[model samples]
Target: MSNSALIERIAARGDGVTGDGRHVAGAVPGDRVRDDGIIIPGPNRAEPPCRHFGKCGGCELQHVAESALADFVHDRVVGALAGQDVPVGEVLPAQLSAPQSRRRAALTALRTGKQVAIGFNAAQSNQIVDMRECPLLLPELFALIAPLRDLLADIAPPRRPVKVKLQMLDQGVELVLEGVKAEGLDAAMALQDFAGAHALARLAVDQGYGLETLWQPEPPTVVFGDVTVEVPPFAFLQATTAGQAALVDAVTRAIGDAGAVADLFAGVGTFALSIQQGRKVYAAEGARDAIAALMGAANRARALVATEHRDLFRRPLIPAELNRFGAVILDPPRAGAEEQVVQLAAADTPVIAYVSCNPASFARDAKLLVADGYTLDWVQPVGQFRWSTHVELAARFSK
Candidate 1:
């Protein structure tokens, strides 16, 4: 065992890193790499469940055991913060979403002659995997794959790629097909019958122009807490319900007892709406459609949520404005909130709950906040994108 090269951890791109700095593909932590490049199976390695394990771009860490998988997620955050020289605080146990829990997915489909191939693209390539079985997506969403193949054969142009987006709304599955044309009365009838037979929540298509709804029984809505908001086409959503719960719970704990909160980069009120009870929340977002949806839901629920469609990057809240709120919830995109964090650093905001998808970017921003006297209290890691290298987390920063 001492002679063997020991795999210590998983790298950012899903490769296993040995203690001596060798990167081994398809290797998991605790696995041993022999001198001749043979990999000895480790206790932390599990047999990949899907047939397309190595090829499909949907999942990268399916071969990792549950315990090791959690470690990979937890280490991603700690390592990132360590890279930025930010002090690591209490790291709560990692929360992993169950398989088949993914509620939203965007897939690529191609039609060649009489056959249509559809699934996620092959890892790092444009080739579609032609999905036979998926253990990642919700069963209801995966059920549409076979039917979609047949449907796309009729509408999707030959030999061209079409984008298929599926989301599980409260009503049912919302389906959106882009790069597809359904012309003529026969094509229209086929789409109508398909939507009716499948009981689709909403079905829309994009030919060459923008998305046009072909069949919508009702406005597709998703519930945040108790309030329901009709989401726009392909609206951003937390990958899984369990994952969303983990983040929301972390956020609630992070901003404990703060009666006034500001939710920056609020996407359709994921954090704002969930944490609005007994508190006044000023929700600000850049996307017009998302803000409009949040405002409508908050108005209808009579919640103390004030919505504004302002891009935090271009017009960040100044220290004077930021000091008005007792606490701030910053959930920025993958590129982190640089401008807003700069302003937040100068403000007297007592508490900050920062939710982020990219550990590296979050660590970069956390460095800024810490330099301004805010303490990095704790971070709760979430494996929302199960079996993937992607990581998300919620953290607390106190002044």
Candidate 2:
């Protein structure tokens, strides 16, 4: 008899798991692993598009078929809820971002002699992969990699790694380089020419002290609904436009007809501004710069979005304050809003749209809400970081 085990599903870390509790790397659902440690390609295995698929840490599930990828995303959410014994009324279909849809990325660059290597770090290592082509980044963003290598070779310190951040703004791509020094007139001119030649919205560098803008012809802005926020350099943004749309749509649906909403942990008014048309939104964030940008945008747009710079972890909304809102939107960091959720569960809030990047933390908070009589109405999984183990989700809870 053949000694082989079938991969049943993908685990949280992107490893294909067998029924008997064995984990296989680079295996997808339906794949068979022979006793001699050879993988037999299964129906759900896909041909990875990028040459750096296995080496680059940017993506993990590129070898998974579309259907299996979606399943992995959905199962991640469902399994998380199950672990917490939280019952969900429905598990909606997973929304996966298309190839080349990533709008923001943080890459690493290192210069050795005359050559420069720029790309994501290798899997489980600090070494750069030297990206030549990527299917995860937008075409416009990917096009800059080659030129960036050339640019970094001149400015990047010898054999020292530099952090490169690329984000697409309303004007154009914003580039920020850390651990790079450009001294004297000629180097400064090169930096200016590079930004202008690439039509970059903003280019900032950090040598040691702090980030200093080298070239910024115009403010780097991002639009959240009708409001235009002149975002700070390398501010947080949804990974992809499609993913943002899916989350926004789900949030809008989750808080149907609610006239008053409290957006906790609101970053740059991504959800508050998007849903502030007829509704009165109260946006609270811990980051000063993000809240300031949101406040400025709301003030200029004259939108019914009030901004507050309050750290919810230290001082979450009390029951009295929480009860005021007809609905609530919670988009906390990876460590979910446990402190805030406790207050929300004690309050008489009617509806909630909890958006989370980490399913484990989300489920833990969901248990608290459910225990307080809130129903887990539905969950919508979003594969924003495509071909990766990272998962995002939006869920509705109602009393």
Candidate 3:
């Protein structure tokens, strides 16, 4: 080991890399690695706030500096495109969701010997880390950990696993407990009291029979733009509000002033509701409950959003139907809407806004679109689940 090496960038798995391509875990860019194998600290490193930083699977890059984290997010999108040999016109700075702003999360709770351990599972393991303090979750969501532990201790069988779902609705917190039952009279009363005391918007439980509403003063709804859509159990919403905003803004800019747009894989009209002003949007979703909710909200608001219940994977919108729109919007699942993208590739829609959580899948689909004469104009990377490898982006493609 003759020459000292300098770390050039962070890798996909949160590891730092030198110019010669040596991987160093917990090392940041501009850091130096001496011949003696000592890592000199660099500017792109941050002290992890949580005590369970190393053990908790909730976060991986907390030790990396903010700039490095943002770089990692931005690089992920670029790297994915490079892998597929897709050319991009521009790549914007990464938009990161702030700490303590996660509006929804799924947690696991296990009760054992008069104690309840409630938190996320360890990295790549089933073991749960009892969260003391989380910098990622909304303050409101974290506040329920203690009370939820107490509630689970009463109803959950000893040494049994309980799945806890928490969401921040416009009205208040909504709690859904699965793998636990409240059949006994005392347990039922306890659940009702817990919901009331916490001012929960709704409380439901599933004891293998499926979720049944235990307490609900009113239906649970989430506001998307000006319309209030009745949310079904565990429906898909962006993990963070800021992340959602960034994605919506990019999509809106991509299809600026387009007369008619088609929102494929529209989950409860998250984009349709926001970007549909003065424009008629044909929103299609596979989920029955989600489409119903979107239709109800659009009808109530007179939003000019036409809702349809169709599985894009099974019966994608053909080019003939897709060509009628001035622009097309796609927010597909992780697998990346191959069947639909094939149709979109040859469509004469002129503009396309593709929102994706998986960069690799997006790249694969982008190649198909590019082959059919669509130009990859620009991309906006968004880091919603911060400190993790999960990356999302919105890209505009034109024919």
**TM-score comparison, 2 vs 3, better candidate:** 2
Ten-residue segment with the worst summed lDDT in candidate 2?
218-227
Which 10 successive residues of model 3 have the least lDDT summed? 1-10
Give the per-residue Cα lDDT of candidate 3 at 29.
Answer: 87
lDDT of each: 0.95, 0.95, 0.92
- Steric clash count of candidate 2: 0
Stretches of model 3 off by over 4 angstroms after superposition: 1-4, 34-37
Steric clash pairs (candidate 3) = none
Tens-digit per-residue lDDT, 38-70, candidate 3: 899878889998898989899988988888899
Q: What TM-score does each of the candidates earn?
A: 0.98, 0.98, 0.97
List, residue by residue over 1-399, the lDDT tens digit for candidate 1: 336798999999999999889999989998998878889998998989999999999999999999999999999999999999998668888999999999999999999997999999999999999999999999999999999999998999998999999999998999999998899998999999999999999998999899999888988899998999999987899999999999999999999999899999999999999999999999999999999999999999999999999989999999999999999999999999999999999999999999999999999999999999999999999999999999999999999
